[model samples]
Target: MPGNYVVVVVLSSLAALVLLLPPLFAAVDDGMRSGGKCTNSCGNVGFEYPFGVEDGCYRGGGFNLTCNHTYQSPRLFLGDGSVQVLDISVPHGWALINNTGMVFNSTETRVVLNRTWDQLVGGPYSLSGSNKIALVGCNARVDLRARVKVKHGGRGGDDDTGSNLISSCTAVCPLDLEDMTPVFAIGSGGSSAACSGVGCCQADINLDIPSSYTIQIHNLQELGGSISPTDLVFISKEEFSYTNDMAFGNNIPQALPALLDWYISSDPSECTYESAPDCLSANSFCHAYDLGYKCHCSDGYQGNPYIRGGCHDIDECKSPQDYSCYGNCNNTPGSHICDCPRGYERNASTPNGCKDIDECGHRETYQCYGECINFPGGFDCLCYHGTDGDPRKEGGCLPVKHHLSARDLGLFIGLGVGSGTILLLIAVGAPFLSRKMKDRMRIAVEVARALTYLHSAATVPLIAKVSDFGASRYVPINQTEVTNAVQGTIGYLDPEYYYTGHLMDKSDVFSFGVLVIELLTRKRPTYRTDQGDSLVLHFASLLRQGQLVGILDPQVLTEGGGEVMEVALLAGMCTRMTGQDRPTMREVEMGLENLRVSKKLASHDTASSSLVSQMAEHRMIATGDMEESSIQYSMEK
Candidate 1:
């Protein structure tokens, strides 16, 4: 048993040791990969990965740099030369260098020429296409030449063709300084416009796989009568601003800022799987350039791509300017999640991703059956007008009861009795007039009821009523019936029917228009204005001139508000001079019905309040409660 136990213990210990070895080795490997002796910064500029001041730290010989410690502040240079390095971007693969310009002078016999350049043969650095070649001075000319790479040949050869000459420009001074000064003042604000061939000229450079390049400048005019100013030619980086003083004054810079592009390879072939070794970082990708390849961090990653575990996921929640999140934001690996608050929703139109949800627009979802008012994130529901309760639920609101005084009720009954007595006396005194008025009122009610039924059913079936066979005539559809005598009342007759002795449905429309005018004005159809014009004609004229308000009844003005004008306009259309010009009976009915519906909607609150008041008064009268504290009355006696 002891022998068996010993073998078991040995086996268990070896299993534990095997599991621990992998992580321990990984830690040591990570330390060795990150540990390197390198100076990362010089003066005010800093750089990382791929570019290093020490020999073994950089990725290749072309990326090697030197740090000069001879000055008060250390200065970094590209290779072992005087070309000082001002800035370097590792991810962008570009560097800014301080480069000097070439100057030329005029001699007694001829023009003296000068040339200045840095050899870029067999190196990672290439002149950026964004740089501009500028010539500054009177009658100055400058030429730029390059040795381009050839695809078929192993090495490039010098060529004097136009393709090799990348850029050239000439500058001339204006004879009148006064005129040029104003133009120069405006151009000095921008660099491209400032070099307008007046004492300065600029030309863009295009280099197609250049192995080497040179610049030469000389005076174009003969040096005989007047000695020209010292001519200068230089290359400037993208967006480098030039001013009038720099060209005219003696403040021209000895060196200008230049951009140099750097890449991984010089070969033009596409990269293979084996060539992706440079993008060893966890979240890095390899992109093919025109002449070589470059490494870049993935979409949500940032930092150096040439080193292992260099790129890191970005925290989008902290960057509000770049990534908008209105509500709670949670960051995850390589991405982020944004959740809007309770009553908000996603909207691209808003600056933030979230916007307030209009709960009132979607009433069913919010369970608000009554009046709903929307706020920022929530809504309020209540009974509109007078009744009170939670309007969000069905059948939650109820009508309230009101009371009136006993003395006020008595006074209301007395007025009713007196009005009835006066009307009874009038009816007895004028029996013929009263009968005619009653017959007309009955006819109008029947017509209104028929129109209401037709609209409610949404279908039209003719339902003719014959009050008097003498005045009624059957006219076929789409036909006119002629009569020897017009039988309608003088004030309500259609002018075309009376004059032409022709009758149609439009004749009834003209009479209805007169009736509508009488209803609104509370005047008889035969009533005339001071000018002796009939009510229909006067109403039409007043409606066209927007003066219907003066003739409208006080009751109509109080109840109709703005809607009265629409009805008046419809009446004017129905009362046109010719029966053919008037609207059909069906059209007049629809117009009146539409105006009525609009009025109902507009006065919804007011009508509700009035109904509640009337109901309360009836409740008081039924209960006979005179001294109740809650009861209210319009009159006391």
Candidate 2:
């Protein structure tokens, strides 16, 4: 009757398990040792490998740069500004970056990329999902699109030609955006109708030549552009000022920028696999890279062949310590034995790694029991801050506490349950308790206005479910079938209140006129045929058999003939079986506010064979004890 779907699934599963469970936090990881280096601000930029700036420090592939001395102007970043490293080359396999853009050729049609349709596998360095992305001026329009593929040369082509995926498209650009330039493309480019909306679109990648790749640009506009841009034909002409909300034809912009590709090893034998074998030791060797490879400690070993007393010992005589070795120390075979001596500083000293100082450290002869205080490669137990158990490092003085109120036991259990539920409902208010507290305060104000209109329409997901009350009543039936029997639901009832079950407010306007004919026919008004008839024929028999386009909903006949004759004359006055020829929800809310102020009516797509031959079902001009032409002022005492 009034939505008792098991009390809305036991109170929405106890309010989603007491508001979606709590205690979250867990991410510590301590193997810590980062990489990728930087250094470059403007002009002739060259930052290299996996790109970077002072995390683990870089020096490798894809020249990972990141040296922005807080830009009094230095800027280089790649892994922080979501991509901006700007230029690096080993003869250009491609990594000349800068918030690189390649929303798989901004589409108008077939374009989808949730990471290239969820990449299956047998993979090996690939990136190019069809391209074209220029927006340099003129009211710019770049509605992005992507849904790429071409795995291992499909359409049958290369790898001697053996990697099935084959072609895909969507690369548009231009809505009078004045000749845009600043390059962008990934997969199937060049012709397929100017592949990424003129401005020279292109996509024809055939990767597997082992080189990392990371592509992901789409809908990015933090007040117009700069997520990724650096295709290095020696700085693709300084580009970066096309900001009309960073174009996806002006929409999908949250913040974006992406591009990644960094490979030097394709692995063949640089070592061994199936997990640990040739981790090269006898003075490190194996190196090959084109399929995959590794190793090199030869002339002087360094550390880690994946570890287990992992390699070490390369100490020539460059002495920053005994490991940096200054004088006579050349050990050879990976010579991991000679550096470090003469004023040490190569990571400064373990805990933070590498060190060697002895200014006798703020000495009182190394202050043996308390204050040695030295730094940048040295000692500091310092001591003196109300010493208690500390000469330097002891239990010291602990007790501090202060910051405690997580709302002090939720304000003492809401003022002790608001003084025990108002003194136990006024000590259980004397018997039958005023008609059970007036039907529990009219079902708690109609379940709090139907849970505040379903929590303010939970941000519109819309499948539609209904019926909270219809002026509440269960079964006191008998006033002559309330004038011929009306309750509801059975092919969303209301064919004139299923031939009159009377009760009015137009019986909830004939159940919202069979829910706007089940939201304009995603069909379900009824269908059975082979003599089971009534597949809801009749909106006067599909308006006199002009079959109101086989029962409406080609999206409600493309909206606007006065909004489909003001919602089919409010589903023909909530199914006129004459309940005073229906109306009133304040005359169907003032005839949908004068069909939304007659915004030039012309739009109803279905319902017409002269619309139910201009509607007519007449009979109950109005009387009493309910033959409901809307109960003539209710008086049958």
Tens digits of lDDT, candidate 1, 1-637: 0000000000011112122111111112332334355668888888766776554556653676678889799888766544678899988888888775323334533343434233444566677787887766666567777655444434575543332678888776544576432133235432444676776777887663343565555555543424245555667675435565554445656567877787866654545653476777888888777757788888888888878988899998898457776576788878887777778888532466678899989988998876676767787765543355677788776655322222332232223322212222222222112222232233233343343332223232221211111354543444445465655556666666666777655666666666566656767666777866667656655655557887886656755665566556556655666666555555555444444455355443442343334333433442232122111111110
For each candidate, what is the lDDT? 0.55, 0.34
Using Cα atoms with residue i matched to residue i, what is each candidate's TM-score against the true structure?
A: 0.50, 0.19
Q: List candidate 2 stretches off by more than 4 Å.
A: 1-270, 273-283, 286-291, 295-637
> Candidate 2's C-alpha lDDT?
0.34
- Cα lDDT of model 2 by residue, 137-254, tens digit: 1112222222333356457654332223332222233333565443332223321222243322223333332222222222322234332321110002222223233222332222
Off by over 4 Å in 1: 1-36, 101-118, 150-163, 174-193, 206-211, 223-225, 238-249, 268-275, 324-330, 337-341, 346-355, 367-373, 380-637
Q: Tell me the alpha-carbon RMSD of every candidate.
A: 25.0, 35.8
